[model samples]
Target: MKLSKRLQQVAELVPEGAVLADIGSDHAYLPVYLVEQGRIRQAVAGELNQGPYESAQRTVREAGLSHLIEVRKGDGLAVLGAGEASAVAICGMGGGTIVDILSAGRDKLAGVQCLILQPMTDSDRLRKWLHDNGWRIAAEELVVDEGILYEIVQAEPGDERYKDSLWYEIGSVDLLKHHPLFPQKVSAAIKKIGRVLQNLRKSQGGLAAQKREALLQKKKRLEEVLKSCKQR
Candidate 1:
């Protein structure tokens, strides 16, 4: 039932007493840990690829929680039925892929109460998608695990208007500012975007300048936030 720091963060956001769906559930570790802790009574682990899918099945079987957790092999939300689970957790995937899965399975999400997601990259795109598609950020956390930093987001059905555009880039400062790794997280973001700017400097092609300018602005904002976090 032991989980990595990143998965542990995602597990913290899962609501208790609800059926959870773990999408792209590698080895189905999160669900197994949740069930073992009595945080949830049931879960459906969905894996897209065959190898991971079988691995999930074996994990569930070996844990002797087969009755409590169902390991399903299917792509995205295809293995999930409409309103079958209240909490849907999609982790260990790219933001765009998560968006595409959620978009394609809108009907299956009819009765979903909340969504817990951990995107490997392009979290800004995922946050923007949540705002555009009638969901509000309930909670967010930045955790450094195994020398890598990860973001865990818990969203619910609602609406919101961000006070500043930076919210999309670094998640809501109000929620993430208190994290121990907040400054480090902002610094990491600045460094990542800075690398993109470095590559853009080599290409002056169509829109490259415009894109670089936008990234520079984002980097500036992030640097400002990082400075503030340090001051605090």
Candidate 2:
């Protein structure tokens, strides 16, 4: 089973011999591939919707991994139990939704050692939540598939401290340093902040001054990062 570049990167981060759970497993390709490769001892593919859930089951059966991989129809981490999986992979979802799923299933994560996350959007929120909570990002990577750049984060439960400003803006600075797509991502962010600043300046309102100031500050910070990236 061939996985996308993003999914392949996420799978590579999974520790060998792990009991893995793939949350929101759309096609169950990742788990099936992992099991077949002998990377994991057991795997579970969790899906909430009927169409995807049935598809995942079919894929697992077709791959002849039904015994090693269990397809469970459920939402988020609700299908998992403590110690059932040592590592969890939640991918191809919005960061806020991923954070909500992890936040809601904190108990199930007690015995888990690693969380491999790939957020589609709002990655800053997910990073903030991880930092505020106990999870600390151990590694991060960037993968470009079909002209889209995806960020993959590997975190473990602990007091992992991150610089607040960098964490809020770029998800993880350590990851950003080695990011394959950092130039593109940071350039896009700089353009976005510039656009927001322009709009704030053009608008005339009672709070325009304050809003403009905030936007300017954000723009400056982004500019600094952009400049640093260029320097390197």
How many backbone collisions does model 1 have?
0
User: Number of the top candidate by TM-score?
Assistant: 2
lDDT of each: 0.91, 0.87
Q: Pick out the ten consecutive residues of candidate 1 with the lowest summed lDDT.
A: 160-169
TM-score of candidate 2 against the unseen true structure: 0.94
Which lDDT tens digits does candidate 2 get at residues 8-107? 9999999999999999999999999899899999998999999999999999999988989999999899999887999999999999999999999888
* lDDT tens digits by residue: candidate 1, 104-222: 99889888989999999889899999999889999998888889888888999999868798888788999888778889888888999989988888997679988998899889889
| TM-score against native, each model | 0.92, 0.94
